[model samples]
Target: MTLQQWCFSYRGRLSRRDFWIWQGVWLVAMVMLFTLAGNNWLDTQMAAFCVVCLLWPASAVMVKRLHDRNKKGWWALLVILAWMLLAGNWTMFNGTWQWALGRFVPTLIFVMMLLDLGVFTGTAGENRFGSEARPVNYFGKPNYQ
Candidate 1:
């Protein structure tokens, strides 16, 4: 598949390299966006629009990467939720409950999710989420079957 397809599709497996590359790209884009915000090149509305545009592609890539590990893409949703609660300090429970569980539990879940996605290797070949994606060449040709 093309780089665009791999980066955007939610129905395929992605190699670790491709996953990291897209993540790096996302990081750089975020930094650039923040820089734009700093310089007033992107106003609040523009920043919000840009963030919305990035959300799906980021989620798509995360889902594909989860597929690579032979897990359902829905796990990506859990990851996001866990992250939001953990890092964003969002809690529906009372402050006491938050005080008890918030400090350690959410952080643990968040780190485990990161290790699951960022450290684990993909299934050797394929199990369910279609066959492994063959690496494409510079010319956009598949390098292998």
Candidate 2:
């Protein structure tokens, strides 16, 4: 798996090791972007732009991680939907108890999905999405196997 394929493509599986490794990289990239931006409006905008630029790679990595679980790419949407529900309804958290359950459900969903994607190991072998991906080395050289 080359860096390009690992980051940009959605055709294969991502092992638990690669998923965590790339996730760490993603976290660092986000922190660096935001840190470099500081509090300047223009810089913040650029930092946000960089974050948006990472969206696809982030999505691809997550989707591939899901695929490794022997699940469909559509399963990835559950995470997105859960996140949207939680984030989109933040104001309602203080609105009323009636809306409390609404927030709780999505929060549960998000946490469950996070556990599923990040903690559990993928299926042992090839699945419908494709075979396991070879680990790529972005630090020194690209592994194309």
Task: Find the candidate with the highest TM-score and give its number.
Answer: 2
Model 1, residue 76: distance off in Å is 0.7
Tens digits of per-residue lDDT for model 2, 1-145? 7788889999888888888888799989977777677745347777888888888998899889889898888888886777676666355446664255467777778788778888998888677888765676676574444
**Superposed model 1: Cα runs more than 4 Å off:** 86-96, 99-106, 136-145
Model 2 local distance difference test score:
0.79
Record all residue pairs in model 2 with backbone atoms less than 3 Å apart, i.e. clashing: none
Given candidate 1, what's the lDDT at residue 28? 94
Instruction: Summarize candidate 1's per-residue lDDT along 94-124 as a digit string, tens digits.
Output: 8887864656666777678778888898888
Go through the candidates in order and give each one's C-alpha lDDT: 0.76, 0.79
Give the 10-residue window scoring lowest on summed lDDT in candidate 1.
136-145
- Per-candidate TM vs. native? 0.80, 0.80
In angstroms, the error of model 2 at 118 is 1.5
- 137 in model 1: Cα distance from truth in Å? 5.3
